[model samples]
Target: MPSVTVRNVPDEVHRAIRVRAAQHGRSIEAEMREILESAVKPQGRVKLGSLLAEVGRKAKLTDEELGTFESVRDKTPARAASFE
Candidate 1:
């Protein structure tokens, strides 16, 4: 197995990890492993169009309102770019 050595961790941070490990009934090494795994996990992006469609389906937006939202979204990039 490959080994890693993490250096210069603050004393308070180490103490907090020890407390959290005991709270979860896990060894500090096991707790650190789990934390690292979760912290480094990749996340997926949700498409705005798909998300809006889902919300519209659930909450019932009119065609005019949906069109207005798309129009506003389209112009937002241009408006944002003007500031830059």
Candidate 2:
């Protein structure tokens, strides 16, 4: 097993960690290990598109409400630029 050293932890934070360790019936080192493990575990990305699709299905969204960005595009005429 690999060992890690954390330096200059605040007294208040250390006290809180100790209190939490006691509550969980674990040594401070064990509690810290658990916390470190949980913190480093791989987390999945929030899929906004899938989430929106589910939400839209639940909400019974209309075709118009499921809008595209074309309507919001810049409608101004394009100008020709000259470089001499």
Candidate 3:
């Protein structure tokens, strides 16, 4: 895991973060991590599954048509190629 060092944060900001952490019942470090994660990766971000489902709807693909992929899927493991 990687670590980050934030230097020279204003005293007021630090105090506010401490108070927020206490309110949320989380350690200051854990609260900071949650804040950073949400800042970069918010709840409103488009997700892969939602995007694929939207594409399927636009394409008018039926559930039965999608289910056919499972029946026709090849589950065999591929063999390593030999160089002779």
Candidate 4:
């Protein structure tokens, strides 16, 4: 898993987060993660996969047609780009 380090937080802000974390019965780190997650990907967001599936449903694509797409698609591993 990846990790993040937030530097130079104001004392009052840190204290507020600590209080909020305590109120929610979560560690400060866990509370911060939840805060960051909600800030970026909120509950009302429309994700791409859901949108595409909706489009497919409206288009009335059959399972056999979708299976043909899978059979014809590329399965190669991508190569890293060289900056040289």
Report, for every candidate in turn, its global Cα lDDT versus the true structure: 0.83, 0.82, 0.86, 0.86
Pairwise TM-score winner, candidates 1 and 3: 3
In candidate 4, position 51 carries an lDDT of: 81
* TM, every model: 0.48, 0.49, 0.59, 0.55
| lDDT order of candidates, top first | 4, 3, 1, 2
Q: Model 3 over residues 1-84: C-alpha lDDT tens digits?
A: 689999999999999999999999999999999899988887788966578668877989989976775477677866779999
TM-score of 2: 0.49
- The RMSD (Cα, Å) of candidate 1 is 11.2
Give a tens-digit lDDT track for model 1, residues 1-84. 567779999999999999999999999998899889888866675777879878986888888877787777753442334654
Per-prediction backbone clash count: 0, 0, 0, 0
**Which parts of model 2 are misplaced by more than 4 Å?**
43-84
> Which one is best on lDDT?
4
Q: Candidate 4, after superposition: displacement of residue 12 in Å? A: 0.2
| C-alpha positional error of residue 36 in candidate 3 after TM-score superposition, expressed in Å | 0.8
Local accuracy of candidate 4 as per-residue lDDT tens digits, 1-84: 689999999999999999999999999999999999988877888965568667877889998966676677667866779999
